[model samples]
Target: MIAAEQVRAFRGMTRAGTRSVLIYRGDLFTGAVTLVIQVVLAIAVWRIVYSGRPPVNGVDGTTAVAYAAIAVCLQSALLPWQFSSLPMRIRTGQIATDLTRPLGLMWQALGQNLGVLLARLPLGAIGLAAAGLLGALLLPPGLSALLLAVIATVAGAMIAMLCNLIVSMVAFWTLEISGPLIVYRFGSSFLSGSLIPLWFMPDWLRASIEWLPFQAQVYTPVSIYLGQTRGAEAVALVGVQLLWLVVLTLLLQAVWARARHKVVVQGG
Candidate 1:
């Protein structure tokens, strides 16, 4: 339902975000190397944990390793180190100009994050390729699952971006969010099932994580890819993601309203 002009403006913003990442191709290379190393280590850890043992709670070593690799790659692309640039803009007062733009500030930021995701995908693919080369990666069981995983992955990326925006908007109040940001980064890495697949966790832990939006970010997509969650279950998981998308979108809007108000009050 977006207008043509709005779509065009969004495309330009997305390209600007893409260009920002590509401008430092060297960083992408370095990031790829780092991603590869991290994925390799993750693969090793999972393999070692399941070494010569039976599948833990219906999760085989291959599935675990594949999940780790895919999760790491998703973490890299979907969850950037600096998830949002809003905090910096807040410090520089550029957020004021951003608010006055034709496009919504949140929409504009989402476009930029999407652009970064596009640019970083190559790095993720490299890490995936390395994992495959090392014989630790596995593709989805079928095209249907693969398609659903793609859908789930897109939803997950949006959820993560919204969460990042929520964090970034904290700067509007405190003007310093490093501590919270670091906590959120690690917390998300663990809770999103990127550090380890949800299957590897205890039943109680898995149940608890299912209630959180983080699992929809990495766990759901990778689990779908591994065919761990199939058919109706897979669809339901995507449904859960859509649910979080709605919840988080509303939350972000509420936060953005307050942030905008704070900016206006202080500027006056």
Candidate 2:
């Protein structure tokens, strides 16, 4: 039961979030530079791995390189290093401010994230273009594949946002979340196949990741775009993304319910 007033409030918060991020041109510049560096390094590593070598396990050098470029770019866009603000607010006794808002605390946070996401979208596009210029990116096999990839990418971003939101709530109890945030960021990156495609993983490792939400984050859409996954399997992967979306949403609600009453402020 969403009211129109809340929708308007969310929109206003989103705009504020976007303006806050966009006003910092230096941050955008730094992010773009970092994304470029990452793509370059990823391309270099894969090229060296496959230099003078035939396709390993049905994946050629070109395909592998392309995967790395796209994966890195998407990872940069979708998983930009953002810490949970909840921890900082709790530590500074600012959680009280958010608690007084007319909009629910979680909804306000989500609105802010949605705005940040809008701002970051162009960064991802720029990375893709850079990959194209470097000869590391490839178009999807066909229009249908491209469309499906788009859908999966959106779902992936939402899945990722929900996962982060849930994790960020841990600050409510711990009061300091830096350690957990760092661990979760890198752990999710690897598990999400944003660094290495699951195609390259051992069978057992792949089997385990298949059931986790991380795979749906970066791997599924990119793999579909590469056409390495097609037909029913591709559809199945997107289905899994939707399933994870629902599951993570429920899990986030459960976490937030507990966190609301557990706020721990420091230096009060």
Candidate 3:
């Protein structure tokens, strides 16, 4: 277990990062507006698609809209833009300073990314509220579901961070990470049900992606939020998320060790 002091220090870093985002909130205004527009457009299309149908793949129009709204709001948190520059930092040798910090490098990175999410929460909540007011989204089913969704969403975010960390660490070996980054971003966004519900996908494809961590990142949390997952199934989903967390954490540690050794040997 991490000692109290270590946890406190990590929290301090998180708060500092959060403050940085707040200070420069204007820089993200355009992106936030774009997200809102996308949410509106997605709801509009789904509305037309489900107009006459009672349900498409077990999701009715109302549930579909709610899912889309929540997914968009959480998208920034799940796949933060801040982390996209990690590979660039690696290439520019800024990672050397990061390594020299007293905190564990992985913790610092995760804390900072999470801070970005925290900073975005207020605006995200407003966007969701606006969508709800405009009849494009549904309120969460119940308090219990909302609480459970919060937990699930946090787990999802952690999974996303770990995956991104692993991807960014590749920069230690190769300067060109664009190709891999593109593949990862698209694959995760599509397969994770951030753009569309996994239930709407073909059976074969859905079944295949279900085993991957990408689905656990968005679909599971959204489903829980919508009350589509509960009881034992909800427990199982959280268990699967925990399992992946352990696996990814171990993989990251091993990779970071190799990366640090490479950096040191190269006179970084």
TM-score of each: 0.96, 0.94, 0.91
Write the residue-wise lDDT of candidate 1 on 105-171 in tens digits.
8889888878888988899899989999889888789999999999999999889988888888899
Model 1 global lDDT (CA atoms, 0 to 1): 0.88
Counted clashes in each candidate structure: 0, 0, 0
Rank list by TM-score: 1, 2, 3
lDDT of 1 at 67: 86
Residues 150-219 of candidate 2: C-alpha lDDT, one tens digit per residue = 9999999888888888887887778778788889889999999988899899999999999899999899
Ten consecutive residues with minimal summed lDDT in candidate 3?
A: 77-86
Q: Is candidate 1 or candidate 3 better by lDDT?
A: 1
- Candidate 3 residue 115 Cα shift, in angstroms, is 1.3
Off by over 4 Å in 2: 264-268
Backbone clash pairs for candidate 1 read: none
What does the lDDT read for residue 97 in candidate 2?
A: 87
Q: Looking at model 1, report the run of 10 residues with the lowest lDDT sum.
A: 78-87
Best candidate (score: TM-score) = 1
Worst 10 residues of 2 by lDDT: 259-268
Q: Name the lDDT of candidate 2.
A: 0.85
Write candidate 3's Cα lDDT for 1-268 as tens digits.
4577768868987887688677876766866787778778877887888888898767789898888878877775667555644577778888888778778888877777777778877767766876887687665678878888788888998898889889988888887887888888888889899888888888899889888999889999999989888878987888899999999999999999998898888789
List ranges where model 1 is wrong by over 4 Å.
none
